[model samples]
Target chain A: MIKVSILGTGNVATHLFKAFSKSDEIEIIQVIGRNKKALLAFAPENKTTSDFSDLKESDVYIIALSDNYIKTVSEQLTIENKLIVHTSGSTPMNELSHHQRHGVFYPLQTFSKSNELDFKKVPICLEAKSKEDLALLKNLANLVSENVYEIHTEQRKSLHLAAVFVNNFTNHLYHLGSEICEENNVPFQILSPLIQETARKIETLSPYEAQTGPARRNDSNTITNQLEQIKKPELKAVYELLSKSIQATYGKEL
Target chain B: MIKVSILGTGNVATHLFKAFSKSDEIEIIQVIGRNKKALLAFAPENKTTSDFSDLKESDVYIIALSDNYIKTVSEQLTIENKLIVHTSGSTPMNELSHHQRHGVFYPLQTFSKSNELDFKKVPICLEAKSKEDLALLKNLANLVSENVYEIHTEQRKSLHLAAVFVNNFTNHLYHLGSEICEENNVPFQILSPLIQETARKIETLSPYEAQTGPARRNDSNTITNQLEQIKKPELKAVYELLSKSIQATYGKEL
Candidate 1:
């Protein structure tokens, strides 16, 4: 059995704790967090602590803290010759290099407090300093997820940036759509199916092939009409920039 | 049973044809298309015609042509005292006002030839010059879809613009993400689950509430790091503009 200790009480940490607890082959040695109250939801009082100096000996120690605190928290862990890992996509794996053995165990998915994520499908990106450490990371990752990759720090950085565009920017567009719907006294629910289908299309077709709009067609009249409809200067600017981008992508003039 | 004749043979037209063909309550009298090659997919040669003047009498005529051709095709139809409707979101219902009766049967969803869409869940937005014409349009809409709304021209205009943002613009973001993944030697499949989850989140939470990322949290360090990682000038511009827009939405400085 692989014994593990999870550090941090954030969404990623809590989710990791729950997934680990469910596996018979994996044992949670402890869950360490500076905020005891946040750790209460993950483990009992006996297996939870706020102290980092008194660390438990485990097969792996996962630091699932925020990006800014990853290096600071890793420096505080004085456990020697242990497989230490942090669950971050943007932060380089070298952040934990202060320890004898360090690696990355990043899950490529957004985690919300209320979301009941199915860990089995989520891709777990692992990176380690040695082949033995890499094998251990992969083995632990396979316990919770079927999708695992030995991603290097450079690739992981690109993945994180791509994620921001697809998830974060896409959500902002939805927000703009909602605002437009509200101003015109239309229910935002009307656009829900369209949003879902747009996501579903990329499963079968490439985004380049699936793309369609007035901007792609270079329909200047519809583009002008749409611009006139948008009242906010920010939204109008976004609309114009994205439209120009799309037109340029298709070798068309705006 | 409501007898209907369909006009055009594009993605929207073909989808409407297939949907209307499935319902026992609706009988498709004839399929009209200027391009005879495209009409073969919908109906046999006897029932499909290129000449709009050869159109047969029906309870209602549905012009599911492109937005630019809605008026041109509607003016060509010689049938009088018939409830004529055009299936377009951006085009106003009055485009068919030259006829005895006119209405809009706008299905608010993206239609593609390859994708099999569930017409039942797709919202059909209806508008007409008279209450009786509106009822006729609603009856035909109800035959294929469960979700129907009585939306006026002004509201439909706003809905179409909102859709451009959520569906078209959102898909463009997916393209950008795919480009990033390719450059990093990462399979775009790694980002697919994240895309699906982002769309699924808005089902329960508002887009504003569901938003999360470096920009939403105002993590300047991570944002700066991401911008530096991006290579191309155009992509860098998109990244900077969208990041700034997202930050501005959450009351943060870029």
Candidate 2:
């Protein structure tokens, strides 16, 4: 069995702990965090400690902390010649360079404390300094997730950036859509199927091929009408900018 | 049984044809379009007509044509006192006022010719002038879909606008994300799970609560880094504008 110790107790860390707990090939050695109360969620099932010095010797130490804390927290680990990895997309794997064997095990999914996710579907992006370390990390990742990739620092950075567009910015657009529905006394749930289909369409068709609506069609009439309907300045600005971008993207084809 | 005749053979028309053909309660009497070649897809199973003068008498006529063509097409129909509804989210119910009985049967989902959709989950927004007409449309909508809403012209207008943000603009963001993935030699599929999860999260949680990433966290370091990595002027502008919008939305809370 591969003994694993998880660092931090945020959403990512909690999720990783739960996923690893389900695997027969994996054993949770310890869960360490600065907050003693946050560590309580994992204490009943496995060892928990706020003190870094009390960390147990494990096959891998997964740091699932926030990006800002990753570098400082990894520095505090006194463990030598052990596999150390952070679950960050943007942060470089070298953030844990204090250790001889360092890598990254970033799960590319948004996590919430309340929502339960099937780890098997989540893509785990892995990176390591050595082939053996990479192989070991791959084994650990494969235990929970079916999708795993060897993503270097540069590629992971771009992936993280791409993720921001698809996840963060996309969610913001959802918020704006919800706002529009509310202003018209329509339930936001009406737009839910469209939202789901938009994401699902990309699985079969490219986003470029899947695109539709007034913006892509360059239907200035509907665009102008919709623009008049949007009262908020910020939302209006976003609508105008994105509509222009879509038109520009498909301008040649039009 | 409800006798229905579809006016256009577009994506919406074809999908509606396939859906109505499966329902025991919905009898698709005729499919009419100016383009004979487009109507061929539905000819063998159902009757097809190119001439509006040859239009079959049906309980309801569904104008599934383009937005601009909706008004003129409805005017062409010689049949009077029949429920003539247009399947348009933006077009007002009054656009079909050329007929004595007019209504709207707008399906709130993105449709593609290549993608086969389960109409059961599709939200069909219904609007009509007379109570009986709306009841008739609801019966037809219920024959195919489980989700139905009574959305008037104003509400449907806002819903259409919201659909553009969540569907059209959101798809554009996916295209941009794919562009980023391609530039870095990372398979765009790696980001698919994240995209799907982003949409799924909003089902249980509001988009405001589900929002994540650098902009939402106000991580200037990562945002600046992402801005620098973006080479294209249009993409850089989008990233900056969207990041600002996100920051503005959550600024008071932060």
Candidate 3:
């Protein structure tokens, strides 16, 4: 069995731990974190520790902390010759160059503790410093997912940015819609079907081709009326900025 | 049959024309548009004309023009006391109140001429000046869709604003993502699965409850790293604005 230790007990850390712990080919030797309580809660039935020195015996040590903390944590690891990997798409896999083997195992999906994840289907982006380590990363990823791609660190960085748009920015817009419904005393549920349809449509069409509205139509009058309808200060700013963007892309703004 | 005449051959008009024509209860009597080329392409089995006065014979004259042109088109119509409706979400139903029987038939779906619509599922918001006309509008919507609601003009205006967020702004972010990918030599299609998953997750969760990312965790280092990774000027602006919005909603920045 491949022995592994994971550092950090945050969202990414938690999800990865749960996913990997279920496998028979992998043995989680240690789960490390600064917060004793969080670490205890996140640690599986095998082992738990708050110190990196306690993880030297494992074949691989996975850093699942925030990007800012990864550099510091990597510097403190006691295992120098073992493979070290981080689960960040934007953070370069070379950040752990201090180690003999370095890699990245990034699952390109938004995760939450309560939300059930289908790792078998989520795309796992893999990268490593050497062929042997790359093979190991791919093997580990294959155990958890069906879609594994060899993405370079630079490509992964941009894919992460794209993720921010589709997942983070899109969800913020949903929040805005719910807020508007609240102000109008309409059930936010009323907009749920339309919201689902918008996302579902992209499965078959490009976002640019799916685009519709005042900016697409170049209907300056409808744009003016809709702008007038928006009462929130922050929402109005969002509307104006997005409008300028749409117009810039299509050159259809009035 | 409720004889209907459409006053524009734009995205909304073309969609509604095809949808209503499919229903045996509604007859598309004529189609009026300034561009004969566009009108001819609509391929309606009924008469097609460019004159607004030619709309007089239909039982219901539907003005699916832009907001600035709705009043002008209504004024140009020679028929008095004929049931007149405008297919606009932002424009007030009263804009057509000059007629004795005025109403609205706002289909709450993002439409494109090439994208065939399943009107049976689209939420059709109806509003009219009188109970009789309101009943007529509801019946008309029911003919095309299973989901029909008698929403007030004010509430429909609010719903339209909400759509600007989910449909328009969400799509703008998608555009931004594609631009970022194209500039970085990364395949934009790689992000498609993530986008689909983000949207699918919301079917069971509220956007506020489903929110995730560096911004939600208050991990500013990652946010700063993402800002540095972003090369496009407009995308950086979008990232900053959306990050700020997330922070504002959560009462902290990452």
Question: Between which residue pairs do clashes occur in model 3?
Answer: B218-B254, B219-B254, B220-B254
- Candidate 3 TM-score to native: 0.86
How many pairs collide in each candidate, listed in order?
Answer: 0, 0, 3
Could you tell which candidate, 2 or 3, scores higher by TM-score?
2
Against the true structure, what is each candidate's TM-score?
0.98, 0.98, 0.86
Q: Please list the C-alpha lDDT of all candidates, in the order they appear.
A: 0.91, 0.92, 0.83
Candidate that scores best on DockQ: 2
Higher-scoring candidate on TM-score, 1 or 3: 1
| Interface RMSD score of each model | 0.6, 0.7, 1.3
Residue B141: error of model 3 in Å?
A: 1.6
Q: If both were scored by DockQ, which would come out higher, candidate 2 or candidate 3? A: 2
Model 2: share of true interface contacts reproduced: 0.96
lDDT of 1 by residue, B1-254 (tens): 99999998899888888898899999999998888678889756789998899989899998988799889889988988889998888998888889969999899998899899898999999998999888888888888999999999999999999999999999999999999999989999998889999998999999999999998998999988988898888889888888888888888443
Could you report the DockQ of all the candidates, in the order they appear? 0.89, 0.92, 0.61
Q: What is the C-alpha RMSD of each candidate to the true structure, in Å?
A: 1.5, 1.2, 3.5
**How are the candidates ranked when ordered by lDDT, highest leading?**
2, 1, 3
